[model samples]
Target: MTRRGATRNGLTRRGVPAVLLDVLLVLVALADTWANVDLGQQPAVSCALLGSFALLLRRRLPLTTFLLTVPTAMVSDAVFATLAALYTLASLSRHRVLLACCALTYAIIDFLPWPWSTLRANELSGTHNVVHLIYAVATAAAPVFLGQLVQARRELSLRLTEITEAREHERLLTAQGVLARERAQLAREMHDVVSHQVSLIAVQAGALQVSSQDPEAKRGAAAIRRLSVQTLDELRHMVSVLRASGSRPTELTPQPSLADLQRLVDGSGMEAELKTDLPEGLSPPVQRAVYRTVQEALTNVRKHAPGATATVRLHHVNGRVEVTVTNTAPTRPPLPLPGAHHGLLGLRQRAELLGGTVTAGPTPDGGYELHLDLPREGAG
Candidate 1:
């Protein structure tokens, strides 16, 4: 494509007035030629008249104007004077090919000899002749100076446009980065909260199935159903807070912590012993992380080693929190479960985002152990 086609806004109506000015100038020169007047009294004024008519095409064919006007310039003083002025304006017009042609034409016409037979005998003397020559030369040079000025202005405009686009792109990237981080954080939190609640629901559902005729078991199942629905509602509300602008819900009811470990284990239909060393007024994020670590560890134990006994421990240190869950090994090594544990991956993400870590492995004592450590009092 042409360079003009590649630009976002190519030569537009902004050039219209300048072109019209060139047309008006040509008409003025034609009128001066018709008058029998010294610089005005030159013989055969048609050469000067034709040069002025040529100015009307300055915008589209500037080089043509430069080439046609030169040889005929010596015939009429008026034509010679007008050529210089028109060349200057053409330079300012910002058409490089035309400007270069003007320079070449000027050099040739000023230096090369004209045939003696073509030189007309006219009064080539006095202040009028000197002024005419000076005006012509000045006009010829005008395009060079104006072309440079126009080029400088275009370069400055291009630089400004580039700077503005770069800043806008950076701003968009920053916004997208922040939104991604927020969405990841939200996913981790939802996994922790929902999984713990679902565990309780599962236990209650199992009880309702096995104790078919027991009134107490049925009531427990009903309570479990109601609480599960309430948990779902709370989840929706919290998600709403995460999505909304200018509002955060830190005052929502506190989530479960290490204190809930015994309940979680007992609900799994497996007996568990708790050994905890927790601190008072622990930050919410740390407590949530500790609870999730134990919850997931117990869940794996229930699914894979149903008859195994489990132990949960929470250790609170000066600046960090540690939690461990272990279970007695099944008669056979636990087989892999069919569906994936999205919860386990979420637990790890939760801990890591808060500058914490987790480890899980088979124990030499024929058991499985999972451990987590997280910042206790700071940003985590």
Candidate 2:
């Protein structure tokens, strides 16, 4: 491949017009022949023309054209074709450095003792020969230096382009990371403000209902307690959907369902019972809402009604699914702690979006109850 590339480049168009250089070489041949060749020596004239005209083929056949000029160059004063061919050969040919060294030596030897030059071998001083040698070496180095610069520039430009593309890719990935974190922050903020308040209300109402003596006051307290508890439950389900990692299918495996409620209770590290008269294969949306409703209700029970037993029930009645989760009265007040109640509003949004309704209030026996209704079709 390297050899092929060198061959291809040898034939490529030049910055200095190739045809004009060829003509200049030919003119040098004519000038030298007129000045030095005797009228009878037509053979010497023919050899000079052969060397100069060979420049037309220098690019197309760089090495071959250079060899063609060597014999003619040793005898004739005209050596432009020889010099031009050496330049192309050094620049575009394979083994460029090695070839340049060899050609430099050849140029000095070929030009130094040429028969047509003014200084003959017998009269040539050591100083004069050194000067001639320097001239030849300089001539050879010029073209080789120009070609090396062109190759260097081409390689540098290509490397710069690669670096630019890599930087753009890195920037794109960084921008995406920033955007994802910003979205997750928004989800967290909503949960903090809403979930904390609803959970707080539910816990307080339960205590108030148990403490109240008047029938009216007790009933009012029960209603408030149930609503708050149920609101808290709904929010958990809604927020869970958002909080699950949607970016990966593996992370989004099926959520807890009606059958899975027992498992949820067992793993909850709390005392709870689950009962269901509901059939299997509920639509995913309804199932998720139902599971979340029950899950959140039980969570609130654990949080506020310590030592309370939560009872979960599922019913399929009148083309609808009904889920009820209730807890016994708390033996002790809940721990006073800061909370993020952000999930309450999110729960309402979940039920409404799925065409379902959920409610929570105090039970008659100084406890709390949460109920949710979703239609058989698309959660009604």
Evaluated with lDDT, which candidate comes out highest?
Answer: 2
Error of 2 at 116 (Å): 11
lDDT tens string, model 1, 1-380? 44321223333335445555666677676665554224443444555655667776554555566555554455443444345444444544566676656655564454333444564546346687667666645656665766566656667777898999999999988987798578657856775777566766856676685676886566556656655655666776676555553344345556886566667665654568888878878877787788778777877886788568888888877678888889998755566678576877898889888888888889998889998888886352
lDDT of each: 0.65, 0.72
Model 1 worst lDDT window (10 residues): 4-13
TM-score of each model, paired residue for residue: 0.43, 0.38
Please give the lDDT score at residue 102 for candidate 1. 67
lDDT of 1 at 105: 58
